[model samples]
Target: MASAPQQSLPLFYNDLQPLSSQQHADFKIRSADKAPFLAKQHAVPVTVEEFPLVQRFMPIVFSQGEEPVPLALMGLNEGINTFFDEDGSLNEPNFYVPAYIRRYPYLLARLRPDSDELSLCFDPTTDTVGAFEEGEALFVNGEPSETTKNILQFNEQFEQAGARTGQFMKELKELDLLIDGEVTIQPDGAAQPFVYRGFMMIDENKLNELRGDQLRKIVQNGMLPLIYAHLFSLGLMRDIFGRQLRQGKMPEPQLVQPTA
Candidate 1:
C-alpha cells in the first residue's frame, strides 16, 4: 500500500528511541514481524483467554511436557476463555496455553512496566491501538472485534491483507528489502484495480490516515529507510549537571550571571 505525503509530527519524548539508561530507560526495536519492528518495552499478560472462536477446529495436542495448552490458538474458529490476571507471580501456565503459543508464536505481546502491577494483554495480529481492555475479540464467522471510545479510533484493514496481516508482521523483521518501498496509484480509466509499488503519494488527502502502525509498514516496506533521523530533537540537549536545556544548546553558550 502506497502512503501519501503527509506532515510528520514533532518528536515525542518517549518515542525518540530513548537512550539505554540504568535499565530504567532503554529502547530496542522488536520485529512486529521483525526484530526492530517493536519499540523496546517489557510486556506481560493482563488477560489470557481460551478463544474457541479464534480457531478453525479442535485439534489434537501433541506434547510430552506437562504444560497447559495455549488458551488462544491461531487459525482456530472456536473461541477460548480469557482470564484477566496480573501480578509478578503469575506463571506462563497460569495464563498462557503452551499449545496456543506453540502454534502461533506471535499471538501475545507481553509488557511489564516498573510503575504498574498489571500485565498488558495484546493480540499482536489484531489488537487495536491504546489499551487492550477496550478492544474486542476476533469473531469466528466474520472479522475481529474491538471496542473503541470513538469511531475515529480504529485499525481499518485495507487491501485484503494484500499482505496477510500476520504474515507481514512476522516477515518484516526478517526481510532485508521490499520489492518497492513506496507506490503510486493513478487510478486510470484504462485499467481497473491497479496496485502500485513504492512510496509515492496517490493524493494529499490520504495523509490523514497516517498512524503509528502504518508508519511501521511504510518503513519496513521500504518507504522510509532513514525515517529514524527525523525523530530526534535538533535543539533539546542534556547538560553536564543532568539538566535538560530545551532551547537550542550549542557547544558555546551565553553565561547570564557572569562566570566566576
Candidate 2:
C-alpha cells in the first residue's frame, strides 16, 4: 500500500531548480500553515533515524520493490491521509510530523549525472520559497542567509540519515528478514475483513530463526530495536483503518471467497 514516486521527479515535487543567489538573491521562504502537497500523499520515504519517533505515530513499512525503501504510512490506502484534512491542516495537534514532510520544497540533489557533488535544490512550484516581499530571507548581501544555511544543514543531515537507512535496508535484505506484508482488520458488523497488502515488513519468523551470533550482532548494532519498533507499530494498522472508516474514506469492501 506504500510506494514512493517512481516518476522523473520525487514525490510532491513537480519540478526541481538549483537554488542560486544570482537568480534568487531576493528570494524569501514563507512559512506555510497548510501543505496541500501532503493532502493525498499516503506514504512518505523515511530514514532509519526516524523509526523510533515514526513508530510512535504511524506504521513504518517497506515499499514493495527490488530496492525497497522504508515508508511511513499516513493512511492505509492511496490518496487517503487520516492525519491531515483536505486542506492539509493537521486533524490533531502534537502529532509527530515526519522529517520527510518537514523538509519539503528543499532538498540536496546532484545537478549533474557525472558529478558526485549534490547541490541545494527546491521545487519552484511551491510558494514556500520565492522572490517574495515578506518571509525569511534566503540570501543577504549576495550570500546565503542564516535561514538558507539552516536549510542546507537540515538537508545535509537528512541525506546522511538516508544513507544510514539505505544501509539498514541492505542488511535486512542480506539477512532475508523482509517479507510481504498483509493486514486484515474486521470492524464490528462488517461482512468481510479489510485486507491491506502491497507492502513489505520485517519477517519476525526469520528474525527469530537467526543464529545466536547473528541475533547478537543485530542487537549490538541497534537493528533489533528498529525491527521491533516496526513490528509493534503494525498494531496501528487497525487504528488507521478505523480512522479511514470514521472519516468516510474507506473504500468498498472487497470480499475474498473461501476456496472449496
**Candidate-wise lDDT, in order:** 0.22, 0.84
Candidate 2, 1-260: lDDT as tens digits: 21122257777777778888888889999888998988887888889888999898888889887889988888888888899999998896857898888988887887666788888888888978888989999999999999999999999999999899999999999999999888888899988888888889998889989999899999999999999999999998888888888999988653121110
Number of the top-ranking candidate, with TM-score as the measure: 2
Question: lDDT per residue, candidate 1, 1-260, as tens digits?
Answer: 21111243111111111111222111122223221111111111111122222221211111112211111111111111112112212112332332222221111111323443322122222222222333242221232223211111211121122224334323433332212112222223524332212111112233234567766767676434222211121111111111111211212222111000
Q: What TM-score does each of the candidates earn?
A: 0.16, 0.94
Model 1, TM vs. native: 0.16
Q: Cα deviation of 9 in candidate 2 (Å)?
A: 1.2
Q: Model 2 Cα displacement at 63 (Å)? A: 0.4
Instruction: Compute the lDDT of residue 126 as modeled in candidate 2.
Output: 93
